[model samples]
Target: MLNIAIAQLNYTVGDFTSNVAAIIGGMRTAFARAADIVVFSELAVCGYYPGDLLEDAAFLEQFEPALEKLLEASRQMPKLATVVGTVRRNTGAGKPLHNSLLVIQDGIIIAEYHKQLLPTYGIFDEYRHFEPGQQTACTLRIAGHHIGFLICEDGWNQPGRDYKINPFDALRRAGPELVISINASPSDIAKRTLRHSTLGKAAADTGLPILFVNQVGGQDQLVFDGASFALMPDRRIVFEAEQFSEDFQLIAFDEGNFTAAGGAALPIPSQGLSTEEFARRQIILGVQDYARRCGFSKAVVGSSGGIDSALTLALAVQALGAENVAAVTMPSGWSSEGSVSDSQTLCANLGIPLYVHPIASLVQQYGAGFKDAFAAPLQGLPLENLQARIRGTVLMEYSNSFGALLLTTGNKSEISVGYCTLYGDTNGGLGLIGDLYKTEVYALSRHINLQAGRELIPEAVISKAPSAELAPGQKDTDSLPPYEVLDEILKWHLEGRRMPQTEADAAYGFVQQLQAGDEGRQLVKRILGMVARNEYKRRQAPPLIRVRARAFGSGRQMPIAAKY
Candidate 1:
């Protein structure tokens, strides 16, 4: 019988001290548990996707010392073999380094396996810094069992479609008793299901029990949902770690079956969180980690009393706590009475302080200055944008004065069509709902209230018509289609085939039906044109927590100058 511990940890990028400390902590726990082996997630040393930090000579210099530290720790727990992911210098052709995994036992590095597949699409660009390893399986014999290893992407090509060389096949040929796959996989709506299906199929087809371990935490726009699990060839997922948090578990493998550490049969994990609940947890973690990493203890959101701002405030309060979150209502002359009242109710429900900074005087001052300087009355579109800009400026001033990170409230629909003023609602350190559609914004707002068993976001705010309140009687529908229609178009156009298969088919069919009529076709064309023209705005917008497969940031790279 072989006992293995899964260390699902959260590592900050470039923080070698904390990362090593966490890894050693896991090792110590595994040692106490009397486990023979402990497996950590990919890049547990310097964190996953270090980007350009891998290019720094000083950054690269820290790895050897970190490994030595791990080696030293391993010497204390001589019986436990520690498997960790880090980087190593490459001597052969191609990149300067390779994404490597090391197996250490009794202060000796017994086995080293370089990652063979380098993923370059979507949010991953591993090929930029690390060279791929040779197409050979890395297997080691320990505790009377043979184990094969794989990095994140190596196990993804089970269908033999993504990459030419199937690492699973090669590992199968080598004939190991089990396979251990380490990953830093990011979370999305259907991503957990995808991982289960893909890896489960691989395990079932190869008849190899696979242990998949992953990291959890918010990294910039990416959120890695740990949800680590062990799969059997016939049983699929038998065990799963917690999602969106750090977890450590020990399992025993004996006679080709995995069980609890005490040799009892492991119960199958639950079906996991719903899509709305998943997004809430993901965004909360994103806000928490982003604020902490950026050196801000508090977050401030401009409260418009609309669904977007209300939801942002609620999520922010949950993430950073009510004491660490503040809401500011910058109502203008055109602002509705419900705006301030709803904001008050929302903040009161959320247990956060609300500050009202009336922006009517500020708008008048800006309009007067513009008329005097430009010799034209600041009315029409410029005047409307001026109110948003003044609110944005006031929010920024509050952020600076109070040392709070400003949270932008623009959702995906307005952002996609360029309905937002660049320097106005777009001005924030981080966007909380930028990846969510306006409809999704409402859905999540309702979800929050339901989860809280009360109106945390205020029912009045959720029921109100979507508006910027920049001009008298202004509604978002005046500038764009209703969110119900607009979100479908944006999804079909922007995400396309990248969406989940069912969602993609629904979006495609909805768009095809719209194209069946001339007015609908014209509407589709106009929305597409708006999206194309809004590239410049999105390019300048703040980075949002990515909950979708194809977000507006690095995932969707569109040229601003070139016509599509």
Candidate 2:
């Protein structure tokens, strides 16, 4: 049996040097296990979703030298055959760009393959940078078997496009003993079913064992959940890798036979927690990753007794724990009575320290100072934002004083359609729920409460009308459409179709035609246009946990200054 290892690794975008080190570290683990072949995710050396930097020779320059390092490292392990990824140069006298996977054995480059398919649609524009390779799949002779390899976009799709060659056809003709596919595929809720079915099809069609390896961890707005796996000749998952984290698994095969001797299935992250539990767990993972990567640990948040603060505090408590999480509650003239009490409830439940300071007098003091400068009545959006800004300022004061990461709790639905203050409520080192739509936030809250079989998010918190409460009587529905309608439109329009430039050409117009005449021509175009227009805010907003299929993450690249 030929033993194989799939390195499901976490990598940061633009951290070229560290990425190389990670690749070597993972390789060393595989060698210690005494595996015959060790494979890594596509583009693991340079991180996936490099965006337009691929067009810059300087970026590729930073990427190529790592290949030599891997080759050099291979010398240390004589028995291990390594397959790793890096950007490669195009052969002809054209702007050189090729997504590549290289196989090295005994300090020798045995075979190198370029990606055959270059995805140019939604969230991908590989055609803009990399030139597709027209070669058949390359095979490496390992452990008395001819094993084939393909890059991220190769051998995983069934397309009718002229640009990308069908590598599977060529590889099938070559009749390799095993076909290995490497990917930097993105993650989402729907991923589990889709990956299972699609990989099953690949295994069934090839009748040859197929190994699929993926990347893990967050990069900018994207989070890659590494659910790497191997499909046996029988079309069953013979080997499985962990999800949402980095791991290494070994699969042994003999000629056309397969065996999985290592790696265990990881339990899914506990998604349901009391309001205290849910917010804490998701936020902790979220805060821990973003803050730790960006270089911070302790964090502080505005701890108004409101649901948002309650939620953000829950997350911070989980992430930084009681000692590390600091909550500052600043109540202005309009701040409700039970707000502080609710905030205290959450902080007490989570065992975190709460700081209560009045902002009402401060606002009055500032208003008095600005009496001559500002004649407008203390109301409307301006007045509402003043309170938020004051609270934000206080949170910042605590954050700066203690060198703590600041967390924002605006949910996805609010961030979409612009319901938050730019430098006010939106200010923070990271936005934990920025990608989770409001409806999802409530659902997640409810799920946590139900699973815990007790009141975690406090019944009053969940049962109360959802409001920002910046004003005396402000509600979310007053400024926006029902969340149900907005979220549905978002999922379909944002991730389903391509964005068009103007109102007439916008995909939204097609949605109007849904029952007009044709069933097929959809309004998906309009939705994507909205997403494109909103890219500026997303770019400025701190990175968020990427749990959705097309979260505005590294995988979802949009041109900042593009026409249509």
Candidate 3:
């Protein structure tokens, strides 16, 4: 019988000691089970996106000891063949490092494989660091079965675009009986089915069982969902590992049939859940891990009646629970009755305590103090910004007083174009929804209620127009295009990586409106200008849970001063 284990874990970038320790623990468990092999996610030791830190000499110095420690630990598990992802260095005249999966056995480095497909477009820049691998894949004999291996990005292939040659083809050339893949492939609603089909097809065509392993949890804007699995030679799923979690799985293959044997078989945390529902789980875990990793127990947020704050509060309540969450309702004069009602309703629904503190009195007091400057009518963005700043001040004050981390809740759509007040609405310990768009936020809310078969967020809240409510008769659409229209353009520009002209003419007829006249240009200018300018704000915002493969934080690095 052939035994395999998957280590789906939440690994922080540059946290070498912790990552190494986790690998050791996993190896021990895999050995105790008498498994011949244990697999981990790509770049598991250094987190997925270490960015340019792999180039830093000082960090490399700090990384060396972890490798020795890991190797020493692997020696203790001589019976287990371990294939774990990590940065492997080459101290030669060139070739700085490789994003490699190290194969260790019998107290020696059995083999190593560098990723051949160095994704250069969108959020990846693997091409910038390590050199692409050139060696043909080989089979490893373990437990009397020949096992093949492939790294993340090795299996993904899109038609039309030139894709790197398949490494698994070369690996399968040796006629292996089983294939093991390690991945840090990030989460995407569209990509999930493709992942399963791809691995299953590989297993069926090659007549081998494929065990797929992936990373989990949120680091910056990228969330790695760990729906690790095993595909039988007949292309049927025999095992589905947990998703959006740190987990382990065990599978056995004998007599040309595979069965899930042990290692905590749980329903994938996110399957068929709407993007937001999945994202909510991802963000809650993101916040929970971020707070725990940074050494904090509780979190606090300002709960306005707005969708952003409501969703943020829901996530906090779910993540840290009602006992550890505190919501402060700081309302200004422009705040509507519905807004206050929604906030209170959501607090009760989530079972969290709410503190109602009217900011009108504070605003009035500030007005009295600045009577000279406030003698004239308060107008434009400055006045609108002041109210937001006031709320930020109160939330931070509470954070300091209670030692609770503050979670900022700005959606990707808002953060993309400077719809947020920099130090005001942007002030917090982390931006929970900073990677998600406005439309995505609503979808996620609906998914959550649907999943629970009850309304956690009110039906009116979902149906109502979104607003900051800092000004009378305020609505997001009053300043920006409708979310449907805006999200379409954003998906084209951001995800499709295309300019306006590149989009289908009918799908993007708004270009004509944008170029029609001064008013058009001005509105487009406002939207585009905010998007371009807000890079700085996103750069400073606290780390958020990344539900997508590409989010605004570390996964995507744009020049704050660049003109798009």
Please provide, for model 3 over 374-402, each residue's C-alpha lDDT reduced to its tens digit, 9 standing for 90 to 100: 58655567778989989998999999999
Per-model CA lDDT versus the true structure: 0.92, 0.71, 0.77
TM-score of each: 0.99, 0.84, 0.85
Task: Judge candidate 1 at residue 47 and give its lDDT.
Answer: 94
What C-alpha lDDT, on a 0 to 100 scale, does residue 521 get in candidate 1?
Answer: 100
Assess the local accuracy of residue 157 in candidate 1 as a C-alpha lDDT between 0 and 100.
91
How much RMSD separates candidate 2 from the native structure? 5.7
Query: lDDT: which candidate is best?
Result: 1
Clashing pairs in 2: 221-553, 222-553, 222-554, 275-456, 275-457, 507-525, 507-526, 508-526, 510-523, 511-523
lDDT of 1 by residue, 112-207 (tens): 999998999999999999999989999998899999999999999988888999898889999999999989999998889889999999998899
Model 2 residue runs over 4 Å out of place are 52-65, 159-164, 262-286, 449-456, 496-539, 553-564
Name the better of 2 and 3 by lDDT: 3
